[model samples]
Every structure is written in structure tokens, then in C-alpha cells.
Target: MHDPLQYEGRKVVVTGTASGMGEATAQILVDLGAQVTALDIKETSVDVETALTIDLRDPASIDASVAQIEGPVDAVFSCAGLPGPPFGELDTMLVNFVGARHFIEALIPQIVEGGSVGCISSAGALGWQEQLPILMELFARETFEDQKAWLEANQETWGWSGYLWSKYAIDAWVGWRGADLIEKGIRLNCINPGPTDTAMMPAFHELAGKEVIDSAIGPIGRYSTAIEQAWPLVMLNSTRMSYVCGEVLWTDGGFIGANSTGKQGGFGEL
Candidate 1:
């Protein structure tokens, strides 16, 4: 078992702490004796030592956060993102991909040496793993406007392809960010979670239906609790995982292993 005492006296900035896995991550960190700064939207209720409300979609809000939040931070745990409304996957893509990229670019300098940064992607993100070329093209463009333009130009061709594509970008970032962050003494990584019993569960079900939700293959038999999924993140953000970088730690049980064809993974497959 990993020692929770490993994080004593570290400072962490956690996004999406308003609820769900974000809340679970923050609670665990605080309990471990880390000074955690939480971030969510304008509407959040979790009372912590420090909580920053951010309109993650708006670059200005993100900038304000970096400007105001105390630094040099030991780690950044970006957990604020959305599945958005049913049929509004574009919003999901924007919040998850574009907004998250801005967060990294703006905050990289603040990460303390031996510090780590990680985010929570979903098992669903695996669907876009093969489109490296297109995803790279999207990453090349920096501003939200560029990403929005790419989405607009391709919306007709892609439909709600944004959500999956955004996550694809996230996974790509994890794989590609070590060069930039490693030099600063900070490591970057992420986790891909399978379906969980969060408020977002209803939104995902509403968008893709129960079959999609139930299809999140896991050896655990049923969906995981938010706290169950929060452990890997807690370790990833601390110095305890000092040598680990540019990796996506899958917290999705056997979900990815069960993704035979993504549509139908026979009863058994290794």
C-alpha cells in the first residue's frame, strides 16, 4: 500500500473539486496533510483551505487563477471538465481539451521540482486513440479560437466527435509533455477512469444511453466509487511517484482490457 504520509506539507492545486472524483481527490489529499487549493465553477459548495472558482472555458478566468493562486505549486490536478448537455459534446470538447491546454501552458512554470501534474480522462477517451495525426494537428494550434475553428470547420463532418477527440488530445498531451515539464522538475501524467457513480453519470447516460455506460468494461463487476478512482491521482501528484512521467495510469479496472472491439468484447479476452 502507498503511504498517505508521503504528501505531508506538499501543496496541491486541484480542479473540479465541487463534487465527484474531484471532491474525493481533494478530500484524500487534505487528509494526507497536503495543502490543497480546489477549483470548480462559479457555483461550488466544497469548503476547503483554498478554493478558486474558474470558468474553465474562458481563458481569462484561467489566467486569473494562475495570477491569484499561491505558488510555486507542488502539483496541479486538473479535474474540472464537463460531459455537458446531451448533444452538446462540442462544449465537452472545449472544456476538456482547449481549456485544459490553456491551464497547462499557463501553469507549467509554477510546478515545483519533483512535483507532478495529472488529470482524469475517461475510458471513453480510448475510442480516439488511433487518430494521432488529426489530434496532433489540433494540438499544434494554441489558442481556443484555433481549436474552436477546427471544431466549427469539422462539425458537419464529425458531429459530436468533439468529446472523444478532446480526450484524445488530453492523452496526447500526457504522452508529449514530459520534455517541457521534466526540465522544470515537474512530471506530467493522467488517469483514464471507467464509468463511475458521479453526477456526470446521468449526463453521460442521457447522451449515449445505458448501453454505453454499462459497456465501460471493468473486472471489478460494477462501477467504482469516486474515492476508489482518486487514489492513483493522489499518488501521481505527489513526489512519491517522482520518476513517473508522461504516462496515463488507467484507473478503469479491466475496462480497457474488456474493450475487445469497443462495441462487443467477448466474455473473455486478455
Candidate 2:
């Protein structure tokens, strides 16, 4: 049988594999015969080629884990993230954007020339374009330390919602950095998933109330499964998607579309 997705025997690295979309993606890759190296703050139950503990908030931890993974990596699925509250705003930004970017940049040399990177952003980043100037400034700080310092100094600007700002950063980054990566024969893309029914749901519900979270759902009128969100991400990074570069695939069940058209209710009105 021919493998349309081309994941068979490929060396793939996935982060946040202990749970949610990351766990689902890792399992799917393993099932497709890819040699998966899973990274998470907690241990993953998935039977992957390698499983390493990593703390995205700490650059040392990220570097050490990346050092352990033998490379020439075919694909990278950046699925790790943190929901705001309970977790501090700074820590959330570090995990979702700063540290995640640092970790991905470090693995560039190991990633094959034609390889791709898929990341998980969120539908919450709906109005990111208006904030591009500030996001571009954030990206200008070339190092993880510098980015962290900038975030620390600018907390008053984005402190209200770390999750939203982090997602916005991811969306802007795919466009800003993806263009350069494509020149090197590497593609970068991300998915803006809507309200998903994962372990992270309770945190969101707690922070914004279930009604607010539900309001984000589109015509689908329901939350998405982890695997449902994972498939688009997997496909985005597939060798077959050679021409798809720096794109933001909305895995958000038409929320973005309907919201834009003013046909959707709830948060769109806000």
C-alpha cells in the first residue's frame, strides 16, 4: 500500500505529547510508522521511538532534550502550550511562544531541507492582523532571553490575556518566519483550532466561564476532539503539502468564517 501522507519511517518530533492534541498527533504518527520522539513536561503513555521530558519555560531543558534527539528530523509538530491563570501570564507566554520558538529554532539544523513544522495556534487569535506591528516588534528580539525580557517589560500591554496574546504571536510568527524557512526548503504553518474538548478545557471554562468558551464555537455548535484538530496539523506538515507554506489552517469549524461574516453569535458580537 502506498502511504499518501509519507510519514512512514520518517523521523518526527512532537512536543506536549503527554496529553491533548499533542498526544493524539504523536499516536497517529506512530501508527503511520514514523519514528516519533515525544517530548512533554510529563511522561507520555504512547509507545514512541523516544520520549523525553522537557520544560519549554526553561531554555536549558529544551536544549538538553534537543541534544538527546538524534536528527535529520523529517517533521516537527509543535503542540505544546499553556492556558493562562493558575499558570502565570509570563509562564504561559514563555511556554506558548518564546520557549516554543527557541526550541524550534534550535532544531532547524537537524530538520531535513524539505521538512516542515506544524504548530497549534487558536481561534482566539482572530484579530491578529491589527496587532502585527507589536508582534513584529516582539519577534525582533532575536534570542529567547531577549524575548522573555521584552515580555517581562511589556506585561502591562498584554497581561490581560496571555493565552490570546500567545496565540496571536504564533499566527504572526508563521507569516514572518515561515517565508524565510521556505527559502531553505522548510515550511512552517499553524492551525487555529476552536474550542476543543481536551484536558485544557476545564482551565478555559474556569477562566472565562463555560458560556464564554461555548460562545466561541462556530456553526458546528460543539467542541472538537483532539484527533480532529491533530489531523490538520499532521497534514500541514506532510511532505505532500510542499507548496503550502506559512499558512494558518483554521481547524475551527467555520467559527472564523461565520464570525467574519457577522452571521455568528456570541463572542463575535463582542
Best by lDDT: 2
Best by TM-score: 2
Q: Model 1 RMSD to the real structure? A: 3.1
lDDT of each: 0.78, 0.94
| Per-residue lDDT of candidate 1, residues 1-270 (tens digit) | 655447777888888888888899988888887888888885446556788888777888889987988778888888877875763767778778788778877887777778888888877677556878777777788887787788777776444566667677788888877667787777889998888898788987787777757766576778888898888788777676878898888787776765654644632232
Report the CA-based lDDT of candidate 2 relative to the real structure: 0.94
The C-alpha TM-scores of every prediction are 0.90, 0.98
Error of 2 at 122 (Å): 0.1
Backbone clashes, each candidate: 1, 0
Q: What tens digits encode model 2's per-residue C-alpha lDDT throughout 217-242?
A: 98987999999999999999999999
